[model samples]
Target chain A: MNTMNNKKFMMIDGLPVAIEGEKNILDVIRKAGIDLPTLCYYSALSTYGACRMCVVEGKHGEIMASCSTPPRSGMEIKTNTPRLQKYRKMVLELMLADHCRDCTTCDKNFDCKLQELAQRFGLKKVRFEPYSIWDKTDNSSLAIFRDPNKCIICGDCVRMCSEIQNVGAIDFAHRGSKMEVTTAFNMPIAETNCVNCGQCAAICPTGAITVKNDLGPLWEDLHDPNVRVVAQIAPAVRVALGDEFDIPRGTNVMGKMVTALRRMGFDEVYDTATGADLTVIEEAREFIDRLENGGKLPLFTSCCPAWFRYAEINHPELYDNISSCKSPIEMLGSVIKERAKQQETGKKPKKTKVVAIAPCTAKKFEIKRDEMQYEGEPTVAHTITTIELANMIREAGLRFEDILPEAVDMPYGIASGAGIIFGVTGGVTEAVIRYVLGSSARDHIADISFTGVRGFDGLKEVKIPYKEQELSIAIVSGLKNAENLIQAIQSGEAHYDFVEVMACEGGCIAGAGQPFVLGRAKPERADGMYEADRLSNVKLSAENPVADALYTGLLAGDKAHHLLHYK
Target chain B: MDNKELYQQIDEIINAQSSEKPIVAILQDIQEVYRYLPREAFDYLSEKLGVSLAKIYSIATFYENFSLSPKGKYVIKICDGTACHVRKSIPILDALRKELGLSGEKNTTDDLMYTVETVSCLGACGLAPVLTVNDKVYPAMTPEKAIELLGELK
Candidate 1:
């Protein structure tokens, strides 16, 4: 990952850099320092090119969206030309006439990109009259709010939901002026396995999506000194927390991260990796038990809360096939409380508070589930996102060196390269092979890398032979992939012995609830995972000390199987 | 409203507008006449010769316009699009309980106003908010619209 080769990057107008194969011209322009105005363009998602604001004058003398247009050699691109400006103005004027321009009371008032662009283009007088008007908001879900009047019909939310989240729960229902993005039949997002990652909101050019921020509650809790608060940081957060502090991406400041958390008023700083270690022990045993006995063959991983919710809503038939394992973040909280009782940190077990600092927005919703909520315990107290954590870090000035890299408590910090890879797509499946199949049989599998399951595609599948057994596996990254996969499974077309489904593209590293990167900077920051995985000393889940310790302690072998395997 | 009066209002609106832009506008009015746009409008448009009837007809077909056949009096158009689907629009539709005993554009009860047609998106997404009674875009349209609009026809 450290090795950089001299690669040819496509030029838009005239910018050059190392490029991936067949990249769009807009990406090339942005990669180079040229900023082009666009209403529908978003990084971390496929471009729709619906809004013509990003129009660039081509060599052919026609204006086109730089986002969707592919770049070629020696092509002349003109951005913000007089002709382009006139065209953008015309489109803006038309949009403004019908748009509800009461920005003061608008939910997205300060954050609306379309409103800012309108002002920039000086679109005060609209040429057209209002066609039809509908000003209303659907506040059905706890996490999502749908303000149709705010939507510019750019299709970013639709595409993000379909392509990135892989949840086709929402789509462009009608065509033309009547086009609206909605869930199947306008149902509340909560009913579906939306996971509420807020990635849709992240990609939205406008404020159509928002996280149901529980900070208000956390603030109230933090003031209560009687409440002993302990916060756990997820593995992926260490890699991206620096981005929140205006630090560059791929900077692994693990030591400074702990210090930052401590300064942020977290009485105790914990690691979600420890919980991830616990997941390995439970999962490995479950795999062995399932293989030996005729339980559910090739059980799917349920680490992703979004994927789990999707299964519960759309693919209820496969619910039994899914491992009922709580996400590593949740598992860590559960384990922390159980262990804290032994340590007796001056508080009763009832009053102990736990918070998870995660890169996923879905973790917010996952913590609220009935299963995650124990009868008496306050379900993981609070979930502060990586973005929020970084903000807290900056709020308190602490050097990265000031905070030494402390081991993630006991029995949980021990994760292998395989466990660390869980932050990426298909990492769970590959990790399972390391423990379940072992290294000797791993060579026979001609394709060690499942290209179909790898990369940023919506859905992928592969068949691998381990010893005499031929295992079929499916890896679904987003909700739309889940929809298509479920439909195929119901139709009896797509068959899989085991499946790994992540709610967001690129897994937890690109989780819906992670830190926000604006403009075209998202894709450029996508390579953070490979670097993190590469730097880890232990690369497999089986090798994690936390997993070994959990097996040796607390879980007396037989009880571990009963508690985790569900046999 | 009597059929003669309805036709008279249609004529008045048509005659009042300039002959230039009203070509498409007049056809739109005829569409409101028999629950669906009529074939006579297409023929008249062809004779108008300014714009081809085929082009006008193509526009009509492209949109959620009515068919050549007669329709019920209370034309009930349901939006079966995606947003409404997630909202469980089907069961709300099922609450229609019994079909209006209608076929094509017309129904058996002769209330002809109650013809059921499924539409795409009607803009009012926040309202999700489906539309009924042709262009009367209802915001936050519930199954209650089915009962309310149907009662108006009766």
Candidate 2:
């Protein structure tokens, strides 16, 4: 066995493959085109060998979990055998006996891993008698819905919330037959400190956890003749929404999406990136004001609703440190409402409804927050996830792929490259830097792309020399990383002028409501956003003519401060 | 106890233990004082211990000893282990339930006088079909004998 790069060559079935310090035999087997079936195995999470489907036999006739078993030098492994297949089939049969098999009505009918595995393993019949362990569906959360009946006790949601997000709002309770993933004291999820991140729903293999469907109310409003329905698409939605229409991941389908919205009866289609453009300018002003007036250092970005809520519930002391600027979607909603009221002359004008298409389920809850209201009514009338938007397009019987590309409506449609990059992890900080330099220090800096803050790293820090002063900034994705950063700041171990925290791993590009793409979708979608930025004529928010017009015309002085800023 | 007194007691229990003491130890102390883990006590402990309420709830529910609901003054433990199962401890449990007027789901009586529950083992297989009323053990228990013991308690 020849060693290459400290990796020992091993024979699997017949072909010789190199195993380079792989912790488990499964990784080596997968590298050699011997894909093993697994249910509870997620690459992003810890290895849980509860499911015995990935069992492979060694030369010594020992059947072991490939996920947990380490590979040996010159080891011969048989991933597929008669006995192993039989065992896998038996496991699926047993799981099916207790599972709620209402596939036609299930939200995850076509997407369910269990159903796919059943067909792959050729499970013709479940011989065991049905033993139902159904529990009442939990719809207490505005963002997420939980159906315990559909849950296979995979512990994916539990692990995702606790291990990744650092929000243990739900955990496994009881043991054996009574075991279930529940909130504190089995209370409703809304009663708990759940930030409504919808990450639990996103990571769930089954339809046990899902984003709450509010399509009914949205459709009703769309059908109403009295309601002037308009749609605003989030920057992240453009990059990932293509996945729903069988398009490739990271494909920017903004034009196609806008056309689809118009076909689905939207009176006018707009871009939330325009709102992001406004945010860049406003937040840059705030940062500059604070820098000059000796205000709070390290102003945290409040764009992510999940991060905002997490701060409120978990770390209330840091509440004042968060930026008062409203998120891009909310900012656009406020702008749209103001524009609608201005357009109307006298008589009670048609109720202008602003429907926001976002890649976040938290936006569903964000729109309903008391602070997001204008004149006793929500600025954003309804919020729907990208997945929900896909369903609406399909329900309207429109061929998304064949539809001609259409441009968004005027006033709230045009956005700069700074606004386009807001979908990615460090894009907010980068955008702010671009805005500051593009407006003031254009002669000093050449390259606008701040590559230091970019990428999928859990936490990234950069110190930039701006106007003869070093400005320290930290960009953090994943709430666990945010928790660590906060702890470091609290312990006086680390300090920064500004911090950007996105609760999701790769910001809104990999949001919970986006179509589930396996294997490194974050960097790919982020690349798409960057590509869009590179192709744009206007690279800075300060250069956007519409933003300049809005600031100079309507959103000026105290009115702008009142509408754009939040507590 | 009053809300203020209960909070103070929880605080006392938590303060008595070292900072590095595990949550289970603190929870056990609170359970002992309240007879069950109170919601208020959990909220207090969450803030004090810097542990999420979800984790605390998980720990409280995982153990068979912990009860979220209040228990009766007297706890009747009937062994349902292999030896006791073959020797017929079910009839004794049924008889005790009938005498105490406690249903299967409602383990504790309305008056809070008695609570009936089944145990996997009592570590005394030699005395099969054993049942315990609080700390006192009744060896070689029968349905009639268990009923008689309950009557004596009243």
Candidate 3:
């Protein structure tokens, strides 16, 4: 909060900088355009000053951890001095001594903070030898793996899970030299109540935790001659995958991704947005029937699989309220598989394998669930993160930027703006509001956007007049925020007609499966989704002619209910 | 004890303690009931206290007083301080372990009758070469005397 009207000033490296409303000295130093290297600092989490790399010199020749120390007015803080520089280097060296030095083969090779800091400081040699406490890596979880040997013990992942998600699947165990992060009783992660959200992997500063290698199975599927590999891209993936390819951040690179997939031997590429439209239509229908026919109120949206699983495990009371809609990728995968197996007019069917490319690690877990399977067969053969898909593109030796853009294949290519905007927080509620309003007109759509269901607010409440009655809606991202809302609802302090929960803050745009993103870069991805929506011809889900054609043709009778929803 | 009994006792302990850090207190009571923290108790306590298994396990492992495995009915504590070591406490510890047929990481007997352990001190430096069975101290204890004491207790 470096404001113009503020009178508070602090000398950062002999330069007077306005303190404004900055609570911590680290943020005050950041106002001066220089950041101290810290492995344990995240803007969204509580101040954990474990990593002493952010230490600054005080006027009285004292040292202070800038992240936890409060910024005082007229304070003289030297951000970088000879003593501080030497101390920082020593800290890095000491942290490196106990850390795993195998960086070249590590998943977080270039992305690792220690590796980056070592290169930044031109560290040629380490005076100390590596002595690791834990040697085994936990590969029991399908979505992510934890390598205890590489853990720097920053406690960022710990805070992110317990404080942010309100899910304490892992915590620091033991003491002193033998301390390690692990599940309760040191059980395998698969045995714990881990929802596989991948936020822990996303927040891990080293290769301590990361998404498991998934390209092996995908490549094997592509190479098998008898297998028909169909790929469906999630709505959030297209906007953020460009972060890996160095195409401008948050740019819509779906076409290039489609081209890359086609070259890598995908039989068909479909947009999961079309499936999101199905969610919008079905979720709205359920909401209206509940509103009119006296059913359970506050129909919770079930688009985010991580949120769905969290609710499934923790809040059994809200089971009836949670919509039975399968996630967009699952919905679309079921349709693709059903169509592939059908003996239709244009049919040369082999064993079909539906691969979902999503910006979610939990989708991997969701695909393997018992309900998502029909008659002992999974709706989706496999789910790969956006990062894994990018790796596949690079492995295929294709120049992504030079490749021509291509459209998703027919039968499910065309989608509504309502579907495309489902990537961001409150985007689903706004989409549902538009459908409930029963309008495709530009004015009505614009009015719905103004109903306070946009932007990156953790929790937003909107009450819209539906017919003669008012429909109350609450949209929240992050499980902690959902926990607060759930508590309020259970205690009878609040009520809403619809509640949408996204486990990750800022929705799928900031999903852990996407490239490493800081808190600031999430809005850019949100903007990309809105921009894509603004450019689409069809503004409403029900108005999309392709969806209308779907209802009349392929999804006639109980087929739509069977394929698009979880029973 | 069965899981239901353990869970009920844990609940009783929790209801009585009602403190901020009740897990440690509840664990102590459960250990008193079964002589060690049972595996099933960790999962039950995790759900009952709304605390993660990691947090409870950390507490259970952090304190040296709590044992994860079952301790024998008659626990043996041999003092190994400088005074006791000079008075030949090693032979007494070895004799007890050998008598119980326990070695290396094994401390408890197969019949669960005796557990042999060495403590740094027993606060009785004057009683050098000391040992304790079930907190009943035996001062200036010799290897033969310890074996004879164990045979009498049995």
Candidate 4:
């Protein structure tokens, strides 16, 4: 869409465009589709003009930066003259002098804009030998990895982390050739409130920052006969997985999703939502216990791993207050191993490999936590997020449409309407309150859901009068919001009895592991999640069959004692 | 404080900087208490802070504001933003160079302790020819004040 200020718009090589009032000639040229090649010029943010890649010849004799040079009334710009292209390619060659180019294992391999630009310029290799011999690949963070040797010094990660994520966990630390991105005191990201949103990875043009891939492990398990692999799908996976298969957003292919997993060689398919129901049971019971016993009043939900990690780093004082209950994925891993042992009777429990089909990239890290290891399932193995799973399914020649909807296997299969809300921001806290608030008041809590915490408020607060006790609850989604809330709590500014926090902005549906949507495409697809919630018949946690069965069969009346409550 | 007491104080400052980000601010504050960044002080910092010696060196070298070596009894800072640049602050810097016989990035001559460096906009553009001695700003500075300030150094 052209800005209204395009009245002063001009044609550049047959492309019509408008220029912002103070936009430079390079900006106008880029907007006009006259691809003025730039090395340091990053789109979607401010231009630093550190690399003179976008140098173009103006109508006058002076060579100017397309990024920094402001447009004149009638300036004729020459973008791809031989002299300019040569200068741009030479800039790449200089940047590549120290760039690590092992494309096969590179996280940015096929997706790298820099590599594509190099191919576009038809450059074979770096003309100059390497400089700055140090190659720093810090794997301290669970999700995002930074390899400074591959960085072109474009500052995209710095801009995205600071400008977009609001967590300037990274910045240019040193000067000139010795410059590298470092956290506070140059500590590893695990020591900071990084939140693992992967926005930095999204904005990075080179192989500098990338998400760690674990799909290879999932593939190995898929082919292993000794591994009894069971796959559980997260609620948000159903909403966004369709988009990866080129289907419309919010397509309920829950049945087909199950079928695809079976075809992919999984021994069993279960719903992570089933485990979500289990989570609701444990979480709700924990909430009620806190309310009655004067335990931590407003207990923070531990469903989101990134949020948990952030709290562990930023709010160590509140560590004891965090819900001891594992996430749906981790809970499912526990149940899978437990059931495998139970079913084997006197025989030794077979090694069960559990894979979580999640809507989050952070789930990849959650299953790897040391505390999550189950007895039989020595490794709570691989995870494939919605988009990645879709890619793998396609690579395997399996069509999601051909897959049939099958019910999740029992024990932890059923979940309540409240459990279904776990996909949303405050769903976990609300669901916990509905199911765990003791029998006398559970019915008195009313049929209507507490929708105050439902929407996308970074830090949402609500006070519920449950029976004789008032439960103070706060739901925080997004790491940036978590940071603000933690800081407030740390400084004694904001206080809450219990908090539900998810590290992703719009909760799991808008997770970093969700399908890629360009900047212009997000707002349109953003509301697709609310529609998914609306279409589900079961809206409350009390109504879930899985929870009912777990109570009646497994622990009898002590379901709350067995599964609902944890550290 | 003597050099050993100064070293102990610097150790406290560096320990704070290593364990917490908030502590780096304290390090800046202590730099005022002690005229310069002493290497012996960093040794105490390394022992207390538990940070690697190389890392402390890296951090010290990175920030242009920090001084790893001793300075003259006094320090001078020149603002090099657009406003100060327009005021020909270069002449004031040149005057310091002529007076101190310092030609490069570092200057350690005589018993005098002065480190002159440039900084970005300090949000005081109206005070164009501003120069800072210790922490106090001398507004509308002239080349004469640059020399006079050096003479007043302890």
What is every candidate's alpha-carbon RMSD to the true fold? 14.1, 2.2, 3.0, 9.3
The CA lDDT at A488 in model 2 is: 97
lDDT of 2: 0.87
Off by over 4 Å in 3: A1-6, A127-129, A132-134, A343-348, A440-442, B19-21, B76-104, B118-154
lDDT of 2 by residue, A344-462 (tens): 96676788999999999899899989999989988998889999898898889989989888898997768988898898988898889987665653432235454477878899988
- What local distance difference test score does each model get? 0.64, 0.87, 0.87, 0.69
Order of models, best lDDT first: 3, 2, 4, 1
Each candidate's interface RMSD, rounded to one decimal? 13.1, 0.7, 1.2, 6.8
| Model 3 chain A weakest lDDT span, ten residues long | A341-350
What TM-score number comes out for model 3? 0.92
Please give, for residues A1-567, the per-residue lDDT of candidate 3 as tens digits: 333466777888888898778879998888788967889999899888998989999999899899999988778889888999889898888888888888889999878888998888777778997766556789999889999888877888888988889888988877777878888777789888888889999989899999877888889999988788999998899999988878888899989999999999999999999989988999999899999999998899998988988998899888899998888888888888777767434554468899999989998888899989955888898899999988888889998888899999998998899999898999999888888888644568777888899988889999999889988999999999999999999899999989999999999998989998857678789889988999999888888887898789778999999888886
TM-score of chain A, model 3? 0.97
How many angstroms is residue A220 displaced in model 3 relative to the true structure, after the best TM-score fit? 2.8
Task: Give the candidate number with the greatest lDDT.
Answer: 3
* lDDT (Cα, tens digit) per residue for candidate 4, span B1-154: 3777876676566555645644356556566676556666554555555443334545665776776566765567788889998998889988987888886666656666666767786678899988787668888888898888777764
Quality class of the docking in candidate 1, CAPRI style? incorrect
For residue A18, model 3's alpha carbon misses the true position, in angstroms, by 2.8
